[model samples]
Target chain A: MAVDTKKCVGCADCVVACQTENNVPHGFCRDWIVENVKGTYPSLDMKFQSERCNQCENAPCVRCCPTGASHIVEGGIVLVTHDDCIGCGACVEACPYDARYIHPQGYVDKCTFCIQRVDKGQNPACVDVCPTYCLHFGDLDDPNSDVSKALKNRSWYVLAPEAGTEPQLYYLR
Target chain B: MKEELMVSGKHIAEIYPVLHLWHWEISLYLFLGGLAGGILFFAAYFFIIGKEKEMSTTVKWATFIAPLALMIGLSSLLYDLHHKLYFWRLFTTVRFTSPMSWGAWTLLIIFPLSIIWVASFMKDMFPNWNWKWKYLNQFESFVIKYRLPFAWILMFLSIILAVYTGILLSAFNARPLWNVSILGPLFLVSGFSTGLATSMWLSKNDAERRILSRIDIFFILTELFLIIHLFMGFMAGTAVKLEAFRLFMGGSFTISFWIFVVLLGLIFPVTLEILELNGYHVPKWVPPLLILFGGLMFRFVMVDAGQITRFLY
Candidate 1:
């Protein structure tokens, strides 16, 4: 997933869309917006970057999970199997990005990147509902993919590179 | 400098709800795990060196409590899980890279070893009951036949269990307070120290008590040094690490770390023990009990405070 930070308006539509699509617990969301303001008063810079699970390649959550409930499936999407999860909260603590939480239903929960939709050849709910089309979702391996083109044309950064999580989500400037 | 809300030059912040995934249950589990490992190691060592017959009561009690402590600790850990019944899934596969996996595997060996260690002392413990239970005599005879090798194996497993407890927390790199290499040795020493205290409390003879207390002082001194080095190591590390160090300095965990862990746990116990060593006649249970209580507090404070220390902007 690639996010055009400049184009995000902090509308929170994607958050609602994700919650609705995934039936995220009330008072909980699979996605949110990170709003940062730089520079002083009159001349300031505002950055609205949508944030969620980074889908890290070396996911600590997956590595630390004792039951192997937190695992990577097709398209490199990290997911938690509800039945297998003992919900020891080890994965929740192991996550460097703090991307997971214990759901009220008694299991570890986090953004799945809409695996159901992704498997059905559709974009994630957050990307689909993005009003400004700032959120782009596609296979990075495919040269013709939209996310690939965006990466080719724009410079991007991953949050907390020092964490060494190798996050797949990119923020395009 | 006191100006309100006007200056802005890249203010980076994180948004996540207050997480309370682990609580007292986890802390108790850690404490008990180390304590069990420590007891088993010391008990096995005593047996291997041919001192079991002399310290029969201590050996019987220590070996008996070792497995009980581990069982209680494992129970607490399982109780804290969201799907407690599904905990069996942890044993399905072994992942060498995962500390949880290491712990799970270590626990599998630990229980059996502890039972075997305890079995060695069973016949000596309850003769009337042992006479009625043929299986107990058979088990004790078998254990005695293989006592030396079994003792060494128990020692090996105990050491692994002790180190595994520390490495479990240190594996979580996101929490700076728990991500240090020294944690393994620190916990190992802490386990030995607490084990000595337990031995002192359970000692039937004055000579045994005096020897254990003297041995305990070494562990206490080593623990003090390791703790200092732990903080010093953090202070010499990155910004996030320094923030973690503040937990003991003047941060939110300052009071608990200093008052409960440092002063009450290490300093006070060591002082009291030293006084007793110098013929000051301290209370029989005071020093050991204080050390044991302090050990529990150490786990509580470390687990609670470590969870809050994150690598965030």
Candidate 2:
């Protein structure tokens, strides 16, 4: 997604909005901002990159799950079925990004990208509520789509691509 | 770091390295491979003595149980592979130099031999089946009767498979902590000791105790010697290679290795074994528990400590 950091105030309205919408816990977060603080008192640069599940096209978590509990949907969205989960934590351990969590109910859990809402006509809770309009999701297969357009134009990187996970999330620098 | 605290990370502590979830297959393999070593020790004892009735059902049990363990173990390993269909390739091309290849071929041989050996002794023990397999059953009996020489060959091979697993882990030169010349001896020591303990538990009679306890002592001394040799090699090797020793001396596994592996697995077991040998009252079960505990703890400590040390770089 084209996250114009100059526009993000780091206010975390998206965080609160997301928790209430998805019933996410307080201490743990579906999404987070990593700030690399540099320099002494005289000089400083607070570089920020908001992070969450990459929802890979070629996901290790999906391949590792023997029961197919943690899997990829038709939209290439990484999805987990709570009922089928054996709480083996194989997916959690396999993820290089450490995106998966052992939910309180004892199953692999991660950012769904609001699969239910995105399945319908509505955008994801975080995407809809972001004050900066920084979050973007669209059909990568359709080059005309905004995400694919950004991909064509911008210099971007995916997390741990060496893993062959082919994460869908992208950062435009 | 707490003194009691050990390296407890994903293959390593204080780092994030790529790791595969240890499948049930691997776990079962470790257990089964170890069991094969234990059983083979007894098989050798039985064969050299040259009597079926002389040895307890434990020999027979160990004969049959060894393969059962291998089958379960191999199944798990088969399940863990990236390409399960190509497992036949393990045997189709046997590289004698590669321990893994040797292991696969050995499993192919060991499994059938174990069953045959057990069935040979079991033919009269178990009631004859009402259903007959035509000429095959008589041929099977004939093969079993003449299978004594092959049984010895299988025994030696099975023992090698058990110990070779340790060598397999040690072969990873990138993993310097495990890369030691003494690995083969170390594994052999533990395998023999565990085997003696296992037989001691199920077998009866003074002669069995006397012979196994002697073998047990020999193994304990040999194992201790190998551990020292492995440490000396690491210490004398380059500092980069000796990163594992630093971990051994100062890192998390210092206690687990010194205490669980050394004290409980070796010293206590050896002490009890000696007492039993000297005619002091010692339960048959005590030695097995200590020996088994030591072998398993050694694997755990070795695996965890080795991985963590590799991550330090």
Which candidate wins on lDDT? 1
Off-target runs (Cα >4 Å) in candidate 2 are A1-173, B1-15, B18-28, B49-51, B127-131, B311-313
Q: Quantify all predictions' global Cα lDDT against the true fold.
A: 0.83, 0.67
Given candidate 1, what's the lDDT at residue B243? 87
| Stretches of model 1 off by over 4 angstroms after superposition | B1-15, B131-133
Model 1 scores a TM of 0.94
| Candidate 2 local lDDT, B1-313, one digit each (tens) | 1122122111121223433334445545665676676686577557757755666544665566676777787776766654344345445554444456576677777777777777666654666643266676786768666766766786688678777767656654435676676776677668767766777676777786677788788889788888888888888877646777887787778898989999899989888888888889987788878988888788777756654443221
Interface Cα RMSD of candidate 1: 5.9
lDDT of 1 by residue, A62-149 (tens): 8888878899986789999999898788888888777787777878889999998998999999999999999989998998998999
lDDT, residue B238, model 2: 71
| Candidate 1 residue pairs in backbone clash | none
Native-referenced DockQ of model 1? 0.44
Residue range B114-221, candidate 1, lDDT tens digits = 887776665567665553578866767887899899889888988888888888899998888999999988888888788778877887788778877888899999
Cα lDDT tens digits for candidate 2, A31-127: 6665455556546555455667888886766655545566678878898877666554546545656566656555556889888888896777877
Pick the TM-score winner: 1
